[model samples]
Target chain A: MTSQLEALRRELDRINEEILKWLNRRAEVVQEIGRLKLKQGINRFDPVREREMLDHLVRINTGPFDDQTIRALFKQIFAASLKLQQKQHEDALLV
Target chain B: MTSQLEALRRELDRINEEILKWLNRRAEVVQEIGRLKLKQGINRFDPVREREMLDHLVRINTGPFDDQTIRALFKQIFAASLKLQQKQHEDALLV
Candidate 1:
Protein backbone atom coordinates (compact mmCIF):
# COMPACT_ATOMS: atom_id res chain seq x y z
CA MET A 1 0.00 0.00 0.00
CA THR A 2 2.83 2.40 0.83
CA SER A 3 4.60 1.48 -2.43
CA GLN A 4 1.43 2.06 -4.43
CA LEU A 5 0.94 5.48 -2.87
CA GLU A 6 4.60 6.38 -3.49
CA ALA A 7 4.26 5.35 -7.15
CA LEU A 8 1.18 7.51 -7.59
CA ARG A 9 2.91 10.40 -5.84
CA ARG A 10 5.89 10.14 -8.17
CA GLU A 11 3.62 10.08 -11.22
CA LEU A 12 1.80 13.22 -10.12
CA ASP A 13 5.10 14.97 -9.50
CA ARG A 14 6.34 14.03 -12.97
CA ILE A 15 3.16 15.35 -14.55
CA ASN A 16 3.41 18.62 -12.63
CA GLU A 17 7.00 19.10 -13.77
CA GLU A 18 6.04 18.47 -17.39
CA ILE A 19 3.26 21.06 -17.19
CA LEU A 20 5.69 23.67 -15.90
CA LYS A 21 8.13 22.85 -18.67
CA TRP A 22 5.43 23.17 -21.30
CA LEU A 23 4.32 26.52 -19.95
CA ASN A 24 7.90 27.77 -20.15
CA ARG A 25 8.10 26.53 -23.73
CA ARG A 26 4.82 28.28 -24.55
CA ALA A 27 6.13 31.61 -23.25
CA GLU A 28 9.21 31.26 -25.39
CA VAL A 29 7.08 30.77 -28.50
CA VAL A 30 4.93 33.75 -27.58
CA GLN A 31 8.05 35.89 -27.30
CA GLU A 32 9.15 34.81 -30.76
CA ILE A 33 5.73 35.67 -32.17
CA GLY A 34 5.95 39.04 -30.45
CA ARG A 35 9.20 39.80 -32.23
CA LEU A 36 7.69 38.82 -35.55
CA LYS A 37 4.63 40.97 -35.00
CA LEU A 38 6.74 43.91 -33.97
CA LYS A 39 8.87 43.59 -37.08
CA GLN A 40 5.89 43.30 -39.39
CA GLY A 41 3.84 46.01 -37.70
CA ILE A 42 1.07 43.45 -37.35
CA ASN A 43 -1.54 43.47 -34.63
CA ARG A 44 -1.05 40.85 -31.94
CA PHE A 45 -4.72 39.98 -31.91
CA ASP A 46 -5.49 38.00 -35.07
CA PRO A 47 -9.14 37.04 -34.97
CA VAL A 48 -9.00 34.78 -38.04
CA ARG A 49 -6.02 32.84 -36.75
CA GLU A 50 -7.62 32.46 -33.37
CA ARG A 51 -10.83 31.20 -34.90
CA GLU A 52 -8.88 28.73 -37.01
CA MET A 53 -6.94 27.45 -34.03
CA LEU A 54 -10.15 26.85 -32.09
CA ASP A 55 -11.65 25.01 -35.03
CA HIS A 56 -8.56 22.82 -35.32
CA LEU A 57 -8.61 22.02 -31.64
CA VAL A 58 -12.22 20.95 -31.95
CA ARG A 59 -11.42 18.76 -34.94
CA ILE A 60 -8.55 17.03 -33.12
CA ASN A 61 -10.24 16.81 -29.72
CA THR A 62 -10.41 13.17 -28.51
CA GLY A 63 -11.90 14.12 -25.29
CA PRO A 64 -12.34 13.19 -21.72
CA PHE A 65 -13.80 16.72 -21.82
CA ASP A 66 -16.34 18.06 -24.26
CA ASP A 67 -15.53 20.38 -27.20
CA GLN A 68 -16.65 23.53 -25.39
CA THR A 69 -14.45 22.64 -22.41
CA ILE A 70 -11.42 22.07 -24.62
CA ARG A 71 -12.10 25.32 -26.47
CA ALA A 72 -12.25 27.17 -23.17
CA LEU A 73 -8.97 25.63 -22.04
CA PHE A 74 -7.19 26.54 -25.28
CA LYS A 75 -8.64 30.05 -25.23
CA GLN A 76 -7.16 30.60 -21.78
CA ILE A 77 -3.81 29.33 -23.01
CA PHE A 78 -3.89 31.72 -25.96
CA ALA A 79 -4.83 34.70 -23.79
CA ALA A 80 -1.88 34.04 -21.52
CA SER A 81 0.31 33.80 -24.60
CA LEU A 82 -1.00 37.13 -25.86
CA LYS A 83 -0.13 38.79 -22.57
CA LEU A 84 3.38 37.38 -22.80
CA GLN A 85 3.71 38.87 -26.24
CA GLN A 86 2.45 42.20 -25.01
CA LYS A 87 4.90 42.20 -22.14
CA GLN A 88 7.78 41.46 -24.46
CA HIS A 89 6.71 44.32 -26.71
CA GLU A 90 6.61 46.70 -23.76
CA ASP A 91 10.06 45.57 -22.67
CA ALA A 92 11.40 46.23 -26.14
CA LEU A 93 9.94 49.73 -26.10
CA LEU A 94 11.55 50.39 -22.70
CA VAL A 95 14.93 49.27 -24.01
CA MET B 1 -0.48 15.17 13.80
CA THR B 2 -3.23 13.43 11.89
CA SER B 3 -5.66 16.13 12.92
CA GLN B 4 -3.33 18.86 11.69
CA LEU B 5 -2.93 17.11 8.34
CA GLU B 6 -6.67 16.63 8.08
CA ALA B 7 -7.19 20.34 8.81
CA LEU B 8 -4.72 21.32 6.12
CA ARG B 9 -6.46 18.93 3.70
CA ARG B 10 -9.81 20.53 4.41
CA GLU B 11 -8.39 24.02 3.87
CA LEU B 12 -6.95 23.05 0.48
CA ASP B 13 -10.24 21.46 -0.49
CA ARG B 14 -12.10 24.64 0.45
CA ILE B 15 -9.65 26.73 -1.54
CA ASN B 16 -10.20 24.45 -4.55
CA GLU B 17 -13.94 24.85 -4.31
CA GLU B 18 -13.73 28.64 -4.06
CA ILE B 19 -11.46 28.80 -7.09
CA LEU B 20 -13.98 26.81 -9.11
CA LYS B 21 -16.82 28.99 -7.94
CA TRP B 22 -14.93 32.15 -8.80
CA LEU B 23 -14.21 30.79 -12.24
CA ASN B 24 -17.89 30.19 -12.78
CA ARG B 25 -18.61 33.75 -11.74
CA ARG B 26 -16.01 35.05 -14.16
CA ALA B 27 -17.59 33.06 -16.96
CA GLU B 28 -21.01 34.48 -16.15
CA VAL B 29 -19.72 38.03 -16.30
CA VAL B 30 -17.92 37.29 -19.55
CA GLN B 31 -21.18 36.08 -21.05
CA GLU B 32 -22.96 39.26 -20.09
CA ILE B 33 -20.13 41.33 -21.53
CA GLY B 34 -20.25 39.24 -24.67
CA ARG B 35 -23.85 40.15 -25.23
CA LEU B 36 -23.01 43.80 -24.81
CA LYS B 37 -20.07 43.57 -27.19
CA LEU B 38 -22.12 41.75 -29.81
CA LYS B 39 -24.81 44.36 -29.61
CA GLN B 40 -22.31 47.15 -30.08
CA GLY B 41 -20.39 45.25 -32.79
CA ILE B 42 -17.28 45.75 -30.73
CA ASN B 43 -14.29 43.50 -31.02
CA ARG B 44 -13.99 41.01 -28.17
CA PHE B 45 -10.29 41.74 -27.86
CA ASP B 46 -10.21 45.06 -26.05
CA PRO B 47 -6.58 46.00 -25.47
CA VAL B 48 -7.26 49.05 -23.35
CA ARG B 49 -9.51 47.24 -20.87
CA GLU B 50 -7.09 44.34 -20.73
CA ARG B 51 -4.16 46.62 -20.10
CA GLU B 52 -6.07 48.32 -17.31
CA MET B 53 -6.85 44.97 -15.70
CA LEU B 54 -3.23 43.87 -15.87
CA ASP B 55 -2.02 47.17 -14.44
CA HIS B 56 -4.53 46.93 -11.59
CA LEU B 57 -3.41 43.38 -10.89
CA VAL B 58 0.20 44.48 -10.79
CA ARG B 59 -0.64 47.34 -8.48
CA ILE B 60 -2.42 45.03 -6.04
CA ASN B 61 0.12 42.23 -6.29
CA THR B 62 1.70 41.54 -2.89
CA GLY B 63 3.27 38.55 -4.30
CA PRO B 64 4.50 35.13 -3.42
CA PHE B 65 5.15 35.10 -7.20
CA ASP B 66 6.62 37.78 -9.43
CA ASP B 67 4.61 40.26 -11.53
CA GLN B 68 5.16 38.54 -14.86
CA THR B 69 4.03 35.15 -13.61
CA ILE B 70 0.86 36.56 -12.09
CA ARG B 71 0.15 38.49 -15.28
CA ALA B 72 0.54 35.31 -17.31
CA LEU B 73 -1.94 33.46 -15.12
CA PHE B 74 -4.51 36.23 -15.39
CA LYS B 75 -4.00 36.47 -19.11
CA GLN B 76 -4.82 32.77 -19.41
CA ILE B 77 -7.99 33.32 -17.45
CA PHE B 78 -9.03 36.18 -19.72
CA ALA B 79 -8.40 34.14 -22.81
CA ALA B 80 -10.58 31.31 -21.51
CA SER B 81 -13.32 33.81 -20.87
CA LEU B 82 -13.10 35.08 -24.46
CA LYS B 83 -13.54 31.55 -25.75
CA LEU B 84 -16.67 31.17 -23.69
CA GLN B 85 -17.99 34.34 -25.25
CA GLN B 86 -17.21 33.03 -28.71
CA LYS B 87 -19.02 29.78 -28.02
CA GLN B 88 -22.08 31.61 -26.76
CA HIS B 89 -22.12 33.83 -29.83
CA GLU B 90 -21.96 30.82 -32.09
CA ASP B 91 -24.83 29.19 -30.25
CA ALA B 92 -26.92 32.33 -30.64
CA LEU B 93 -26.13 32.41 -34.33
CA LEU B 94 -27.17 28.77 -34.78
CA VAL B 95 -30.43 29.37 -33.00
Candidate 2:
Protein backbone atom coordinates (compact mmCIF):
# COMPACT_ATOMS: atom_id res chain seq x y z
CA MET A 1 0.00 0.00 0.00
CA THR A 2 2.86 2.37 0.83
CA SER A 3 4.53 1.49 -2.46
CA GLN A 4 1.30 2.07 -4.32
CA LEU A 5 1.05 5.43 -2.66
CA GLU A 6 4.69 6.21 -3.45
CA ALA A 7 4.17 5.28 -7.10
CA LEU A 8 1.12 7.51 -7.38
CA ARG A 9 3.01 10.37 -5.76
CA ARG A 10 5.81 9.93 -8.27
CA GLU A 11 3.28 9.89 -11.10
CA LEU A 12 1.78 13.08 -9.80
CA ASP A 13 5.20 14.69 -9.72
CA ARG A 14 5.92 13.48 -13.26
CA ILE A 15 2.60 14.77 -14.52
CA ASN A 16 3.17 18.08 -12.78
CA GLU A 17 6.52 18.49 -14.52
CA GLU A 18 5.02 17.64 -17.92
CA ILE A 19 2.19 20.10 -17.38
CA LEU A 20 4.67 22.80 -16.47
CA LYS A 21 6.67 22.22 -19.65
CA TRP A 22 3.58 22.22 -21.86
CA LEU A 23 2.26 25.33 -20.15
CA ASN A 24 5.52 27.18 -20.74
CA ARG A 25 5.50 26.00 -24.37
CA ARG A 26 1.95 27.29 -24.70
CA ALA A 27 2.98 30.61 -23.19
CA GLU A 28 5.81 30.99 -25.70
CA VAL A 29 3.45 30.26 -28.59
CA VAL A 30 0.97 32.73 -27.21
CA GLN A 31 3.78 35.24 -27.07
CA GLU A 32 4.45 34.69 -30.78
CA ILE A 33 0.75 35.08 -31.48
CA GLY A 34 0.79 38.30 -29.49
CA ARG A 35 3.70 39.65 -31.53
CA LEU A 36 1.85 38.89 -34.76
CA LYS A 37 -1.33 40.46 -33.46
CA LEU A 38 0.60 43.56 -32.47
CA LYS A 39 2.23 43.76 -35.90
CA GLN A 40 -1.16 43.41 -37.57
CA GLY A 41 -2.65 46.14 -35.34
CA ILE A 42 -5.02 43.61 -33.79
CA ASN A 43 -5.94 43.47 -30.15
CA ARG A 44 -4.66 40.60 -28.03
CA PHE A 45 -7.96 39.84 -26.38
CA ASP A 46 -10.20 38.11 -28.89
CA PRO A 47 -13.38 36.89 -27.31
CA VAL A 48 -14.30 34.81 -30.36
CA ARG A 49 -10.99 33.01 -30.41
CA GLU A 50 -11.10 32.46 -26.66
CA ARG A 51 -14.63 31.09 -26.89
CA GLU A 52 -13.68 28.76 -29.69
CA MET A 53 -10.75 27.40 -27.72
CA LEU A 54 -12.90 26.83 -24.67
CA ASP A 55 -15.55 25.13 -26.76
CA HIS A 56 -12.99 22.88 -28.33
CA LEU A 57 -11.72 21.83 -24.91
CA VAL A 58 -15.22 21.24 -23.68
CA ARG A 59 -15.96 19.06 -26.66
CA ILE A 60 -12.81 17.02 -26.21
CA ASN A 61 -12.75 16.74 -22.41
CA THR A 62 -13.24 13.16 -21.22
CA GLY A 63 -12.60 13.88 -17.70
CA PRO A 64 -12.11 13.37 -14.06
CA PHE A 65 -12.96 17.06 -14.44
CA ASP A 66 -16.35 18.23 -15.64
CA ASP A 67 -16.78 20.84 -18.42
CA GLN A 68 -17.28 23.71 -15.97
CA THR A 69 -13.98 22.91 -14.26
CA ILE A 70 -12.19 22.65 -17.61
CA ARG A 71 -13.63 25.94 -18.76
CA ALA A 72 -12.68 27.69 -15.55
CA LEU A 73 -9.10 26.45 -15.63
CA PHE A 74 -8.58 27.46 -19.27
CA LYS A 75 -10.17 30.81 -18.64
CA GLN A 76 -7.50 31.43 -16.01
CA ILE A 77 -4.86 30.51 -18.59
CA PHE A 78 -6.39 32.82 -21.19
CA ALA A 79 -6.53 35.63 -18.69
CA ALA A 80 -2.86 35.24 -17.81
CA SER A 81 -1.83 35.00 -21.46
CA LEU A 82 -3.60 38.26 -22.20
CA LYS A 83 -1.93 39.89 -19.21
CA LEU A 84 1.46 38.71 -20.47
CA GLN A 85 0.82 40.29 -23.87
CA GLN A 86 -0.48 43.49 -22.42
CA LYS A 87 2.48 43.74 -20.07
CA GLN A 88 4.89 43.15 -22.96
CA HIS A 89 3.21 45.82 -25.05
CA GLU A 90 3.32 48.29 -22.19
CA ASP A 91 7.02 47.60 -21.72
CA ALA A 92 7.66 48.09 -25.42
CA LEU A 93 5.84 51.40 -25.34
CA LEU A 94 8.05 52.61 -22.49
CA VAL A 95 11.22 51.55 -24.35
CA MET B 1 3.05 36.26 -44.61
CA THR B 2 -0.40 34.66 -44.63
CA SER B 3 1.20 31.22 -44.74
CA GLN B 4 3.42 32.13 -41.85
CA LEU B 5 0.42 33.27 -39.85
CA GLU B 6 -1.42 30.06 -40.72
CA ALA B 7 1.51 27.96 -39.60
CA LEU B 8 1.74 29.81 -36.33
CA ARG B 9 -1.97 29.32 -35.78
CA ARG B 10 -1.57 25.61 -36.45
CA GLU B 11 1.29 25.45 -33.99
CA LEU B 12 -0.80 27.25 -31.39
CA ASP B 13 -3.63 24.80 -31.89
CA ARG B 14 -1.31 21.83 -31.56
CA ILE B 15 0.25 23.27 -28.41
CA ASN B 16 -3.15 24.03 -26.95
CA GLU B 17 -4.18 20.44 -27.51
CA GLU B 18 -1.03 19.19 -25.84
CA ILE B 19 -1.47 21.50 -22.86
CA LEU B 20 -5.06 20.40 -22.48
CA LYS B 21 -3.99 16.77 -22.44
CA TRP B 22 -1.34 17.40 -19.81
CA LEU B 23 -3.72 19.47 -17.72
CA ASN B 24 -6.24 16.63 -17.77
CA ARG B 25 -3.56 14.14 -16.94
CA ARG B 26 -2.54 16.30 -14.03
CA ALA B 27 -6.15 16.40 -12.91
CA GLU B 28 -6.38 12.61 -12.96
CA VAL B 29 -3.25 12.29 -10.91
CA VAL B 30 -4.53 14.83 -8.45
CA GLN B 31 -7.71 12.79 -8.19
CA GLU B 32 -5.73 9.70 -7.34
CA ILE B 33 -3.77 11.66 -4.76
CA GLY B 34 -7.01 12.87 -3.24
CA ARG B 35 -8.25 9.29 -3.06
CA LEU B 36 -5.17 8.09 -1.24
CA LYS B 37 -5.25 11.02 1.11
CA LEU B 38 -8.82 10.24 1.97
CA LYS B 39 -7.96 6.60 2.57
CA GLN B 40 -5.19 7.67 4.93
CA GLY B 41 -7.52 10.16 6.64
CA ILE B 42 -5.42 13.01 5.38
CA ASN B 43 -6.60 16.32 3.99
CA ARG B 44 -6.25 17.33 0.37
CA PHE B 45 -4.85 20.85 0.70
CA ASP B 46 -1.15 20.81 1.51
CA PRO B 47 0.38 24.27 1.28
CA VAL B 48 3.95 23.08 1.83
CA ARG B 49 3.71 20.54 -0.93
CA GLU B 50 2.18 23.15 -3.26
CA ARG B 51 4.92 25.60 -2.41
CA GLU B 52 7.55 22.99 -3.20
CA MET B 53 5.98 22.37 -6.58
CA LEU B 54 5.86 26.08 -7.35
CA ASP B 55 9.47 26.48 -6.31
CA HIS B 56 10.47 23.63 -8.62
CA LEU B 57 8.77 25.38 -11.53
CA VAL B 58 10.35 28.71 -10.69
CA ARG B 59 13.82 27.22 -10.47
CA ILE B 60 13.39 25.54 -13.85
CA ASN B 61 11.34 28.13 -15.77
CA THR B 62 12.91 29.62 -18.90
CA GLY B 63 10.02 31.82 -19.56
CA PRO B 64 8.31 33.99 -22.08
CA PHE B 65 6.04 34.43 -19.12
CA ASP B 66 7.56 35.77 -15.96
CA ASP B 67 7.61 34.01 -12.61
CA GLN B 68 4.59 35.94 -11.42
CA THR B 69 2.62 34.84 -14.46
CA ILE B 70 3.76 31.25 -14.05
CA ARG B 71 2.82 31.25 -10.39
CA ALA B 72 -0.58 32.73 -11.14
CA LEU B 73 -1.32 30.13 -13.80
CA PHE B 74 -0.27 27.19 -11.63
CA LYS B 75 -2.19 28.58 -8.68
CA GLN B 76 -5.31 28.57 -10.81
CA ILE B 77 -4.65 24.99 -11.83
CA PHE B 78 -4.13 24.02 -8.21
CA ALA B 79 -7.34 25.75 -7.16
CA ALA B 80 -9.35 23.95 -9.80
CA SER B 81 -7.83 20.61 -8.86
CA LEU B 82 -8.82 21.13 -5.25
CA LYS B 83 -12.31 22.08 -6.26
CA LEU B 84 -12.52 18.89 -8.28
CA GLN B 85 -11.46 16.81 -5.31
CA GLN B 86 -13.86 18.55 -2.97
CA LYS B 87 -16.73 18.20 -5.42
CA GLN B 88 -16.05 14.54 -5.86
CA HIS B 89 -15.92 14.02 -2.13
CA GLU B 90 -19.18 15.91 -1.73
CA ASP B 91 -20.81 13.83 -4.41
CA ALA B 92 -19.65 10.69 -2.70
CA LEU B 93 -21.14 11.88 0.54
CA LEU B 94 -24.47 12.53 -1.12
CA VAL B 95 -24.57 9.15 -2.81
Among all candidates shown, the one with the greatest DockQ: 2
Using TM-score as the measure, the top candidate is 2
Residue-level lDDT of model 2, residues A1-95, one tens digit each, is 47877798788778777877877787777888877877888766879978998999899988877899889888888787788778878887798
The lDDT, on a scale of 0 to 1, for candidate 1 is: 0.59
TM-score of chain A of 1: 0.83
**Candidate 2 lDDT, B1-95, residue by residue in tens:** 46766787788778778878888888888888777877787877889988998898888888777888788888888888888888877876788
Model 1 earns a TM-score of 0.50
How many collisions per candidate? Answer: 1, 0
Name the lDDT of candidate 2: 0.81
Model 1 C-alpha lDDT per residue in residues B6-92, reported as the tens digit of each score = 453344333333334344455665676667667767676677866776676666555333468757766766676677778889988
